[model samples]
Target: MDAIFNYLDNMFAHLPKTEEVVRAKNELGQMMEDKYNQLRAEGCSDNEAVGQVISEFGNLSELAEELGISNQYQSASSEDKFVSVTAAEGEAFIEKTKKAANKIGTGIAAILLGVISIIFFSGYAEGTFSPTLGGGEPNKIYIAVGLGLLFILVAFAVYLFVMTGITTEKYEIFEKKMVKLDPHYKLIIQEAKENHRPVLTRKISIGVGLILLAVAALAVSGILSEDNEALLISLVCVLLATVGVSVWLFLSGGMIQSAYDKLLNEGDYTLERRKSESVVQRWASPYWSLVVVVYLAWSFITADWSKSWIIWPISGVSFGLISTIIHAATSSKQ
Candidate 1:
C-alpha cells in the first residue's frame, strides 16, 4: 500500500501543485485504495491486489481525461514546463550562477593579491625598495612569502566554499532520463532560442574583447619600468576591469546556458553529460592551484621573475594531456 502511494507520488512530482491537481490526486488515490481493498477481500495476494489497482487506474494522462481534469493537467504542464528547469531546478540555476560569480570574483581578488605579493617579493629580491625605506629589511622577505601563502589559502577556501554549496542532486534527473515537454512548451523554447541568438553573440564578443584588453594591459605593464607608478596603476586598472568583465560573463553566460539547457534538456548541466567528464577533467580547481603553487615557488626560489611566465603555457598544455589520459583510463574501466 505504501509502495503504491509512493509510485503515485513519483508520477505526480513533476506536475505543478494546484488545488485542482491536488483534489484530483486525492480522488484517484481513494479510488485505487478502494479497488485494492476489494481485490484483497476476494483473496488476492498483496502484490496482485496492488498491481490490479494500478492497472485498473491507468496512467495520469488517461485518468486525467476521464476525470474531466485534462485541462487542469495541461495547464499545470504548460505553466511549469522547461526542459530541465522546474521550481527546484530554477532555484538550482540561480544558486549555480551565484556560485560562479563568487568564484570568478574571488579568483580575481586572489590574483590581484598575488600581483601585490610579487611586487613586494621582487622589491625584496632586487633591493629595489631599500633606498626609499631603509637597508634591506628581513621583514620584507617575510611579508612577501606571507602574502603569497595567504593568496593560495584564500583562493583554495573560496573554491571549497563554492563547490561544497552546490547540490549535485538537483541535477540528478538529467542523468536518469530526458524530460518530455509539451508541444506548446517546445514552441516557447524554440522562440526563446531564436530571440537570444543575437544577444548571445554580442555578449560573447564583448567578453572576449574585455579579456584581450586585460591581457594587453598586463603585457604593456610588464614592458614598462618596474619603478614606474604607472605600471602599478595600470595593473590595478586591469585587475578591476578583469573582475568586472568576469562577473558579467559568468552571470550572463550562465543565464543564456540555462535557457539552452532547458530547451535541449541536455548539456554539461545534465548528469549524463557530467558523467562523461573524467575525474581529472573535474579536478580543474586543484590542477590550477598546483600550477599557481609551482609558478610561485619557481619564481621565489630562482628569483627568475622574468622567465616565470613560461610556467602558465606549459601547465596549460600539461593539464590537457593529463585530462585526456584520465578520460581514456576511465573509459576503459567502464
Candidate 2:
C-alpha cells in the first residue's frame, strides 16, 4: 500500500494542475484500494495485495490523455470530490497564467511605445506639430524615435527571455509526469522536437526572403517615382526590408540552425535530410560554389574605394564566404 502511494506521488509530480488529472488519480487510488480489499478477503498477505494492485493499474498515458493536457493552452475541470487536489493544482496553474500575461503585456507595451514614438517624432520632425508642441526637421525627430524604438525592442527581448524560462520549466514538469503515464510518447516527442528545427528554419527563411523581396521592390519602385512623397515612402520601405532581414536572421534562421547543429553531435546524422531542407538539398554544390565565386568577384569589382562606407560589399563577401563553406563541407560529407 505504501509503495502504491509512493508511485502515485511520483506520477503526479510530472503532471500540470488540472481537474481531469486529479480525478484520474483519485480514481486510480480508489481502484487500488478496492483491489487490496478483495485480495485480503481472498486470504492474501498485505504485501501481496499491494503488489497485485500495482501490477493491475496499468500505464498512466490513457489517464493523462483523458485529462486533456496534450498542450499548454488546454485546461481541465474537476468536481467537488477532488477539491483538495484542485487546490494544489490551482497554484501552479495560476502561476503559469500570470507569467504568460506578464510576457504579453510587456511585448504589447514595447510595440505600442515604439509605434507612438515613431508617429510623434515623424509628425514633429516633418513640422506637422501644432503651435504648442516643438517642431524640427523630420530627420531629427526620426532619429530620436529610432533610439526610443531600439530601447523598447531590447527591453521586450529581455522580458521574453525571462518568460521563456518559466514556461519551459512548467513544460519539463508536465513532460516528466506524462512519461510515467505512457513511456512510448517520450520517443515520439523527442523525434518531433528534433525535426522541428529544420522545418522551422526552412519555413521562416522562405517567408522572410519573400517579404524582403517584396519590400525591396516597393522601395526601388518608389525611389524611381517623380513625387517627393515617393522618396519618403521608399525610405520607409527600405527600413522595413532591413528590419525584416535582421529579425529573420536573429529570431528564426539562426535559432533554428543552432538547434539543428546541436543535434548533429548526437549521431552520424546530418540535418540535410530534414523535411524543410529539400530546397538546400536540391541545389547542387557546384551551382552554389559558382554563386559564391560570382558574388565575391562582383563585390570587389563594384567596390567604391573613395568613400569609407563599405557595408554593401562587406555583407556580400561575408555571405559568399559562409555559403562556400557550407557547400564544400556538405559536399565532401555526402
Candidate 3:
C-alpha cells in the first residue's frame, strides 16, 4: 500500500500541480487502492497485489492522455529529478540518526566529564590518593591519575564518534542529493517530530537553565567562599559538569530534529537551500575538520577544558555566518 502511494507521488512529483492534476492524482490513488484490495481478497499476497496493481496502472505519464492531463505531464518533463524515499529507508534513516545522536551525546558528555575528573583529582581531592594506591609519600599522584583517566575517557569518546560516522555513512546520499519523502511517510515523520517536539523544547530550556545555574553557583561560591579553596574547586567542577549535561541535551535533541528536517526538506535542507548551499557545503567538510584539529590542539596544549569547549559554540556560530555570506555572494553572482 505504501509502495503504491510512493509510486504515485513520484509519478506526479514533477507536474505543475494544477487543479486537474491534483484531482487526477487523488482519483488514481483511489482506483489503485481499490484494485489492490480486490487482488488481496482474491488471495494475492501483499507484494503480489501491489505489483499487479502497479503493472496494470502503469505510470502517470502513460495514463496522462487517458486521464486528460497530458499537458501537465508533457510540460513537467524538463523538471529536475527528486529522489523518493521508501518507508523502510525513511524508518531506517530516522532510527540510525537517533542512535547516532545518543552516541554523539554520550561522547560529548564523556569529554566534558573527563575534563572535570582532572579538576576533581588535582583540585580539592589533591593528595587524596597515595602514589601507588599503597602507603607512599602522598604527592599529587592523583593529578597523574586524573590525566590518565582523562585520556582514557577521551579515547572512548573518540571511538563512539567514529562508530557513529560508520553507521550513518550509508545515509550520506540523502544529504548529498535532493530527496522527497512520500506523503504517507511525511505524515509519519511529521507526527513523530511533533510528538518529540515538546520533549526537545523542554530539554533545551532546562539545559540552558542548568548552564546558567552552574555559572551562578560558581560566582556565588567565588564571592562568598573566597577563603574556602575546597568549596571553590567543587563549585567550578559543578559548573563544568552542569555545562556538560546541558550540552549533551542540546546535541541529542538537535540531532533528532535535524533528521526530520532533512527528510521533510524544511529548515536548512529545503530544495532551494540545498541547491544554493551545494557549493557552501563543500566548504563545510574541511571547515569542521579544522575545528576538530583546533579543538584537540587547544585542549591538549593548554589542558584547559574549561575554556577549550567555548571554541565549539563560537566556531558553530561563526561558520553559520560565514556560510550564509558565501551563499549570498555566490547566489548574487548568478
Models 1 onward score TM values of 0.50, 0.33, 0.68
Expressed as tens digits, the lDDT of each residue in 1-334 for candidate 2 is: 6766766776677687678888888888888888888999999997677667766777665555577765522332221111121323433543454455445545544543443345344444553444444454446756476546746775775678577666746433321121121222222323445676676667666766765775676567666763544244334434444444444444444433433232221211233333223333355455546654664355336521111113333554665566566656766677
Please, what are the lDDT tens digits per residue for candidate 1 over residues 205-247?
A: 7776776777777677767765664355446445544645655
Give the runs in model 2 whose Cα sits over 4 Å from its true position: 1-146, 158-202, 226-261, 264-320, 323-334
Which residue runs of candidate 1 sit more than 4 Å off their true CA positions?
A: 1-88, 91-104, 114-131, 138-149, 152-160, 167-169, 172-199, 218-244, 247-259, 266-286, 303-334
Better of 1 and 2 by TM-score: 1
Give the local distance difference test score of model 3.
0.78
Q: Candidate 2's error at 196, in angstroms?
A: 4.0
lDDT (Cα atoms) of all candidates against the true structure? 0.60, 0.50, 0.78
lDDT of 3 by residue, 109-163 (tens): 8877887787677652333233334334463576678778889999999999999
Worst ten-residue run, lDDT, model 2? 76-85
Model 2: lDDT of residue 69 = 60
In candidate 3, which residue ranges exceed 4 Å CA deviation? 1-81, 124-140, 222-232, 276-281, 288-313, 323-334
Output the lDDT of residue 327, model 3.
Answer: 73
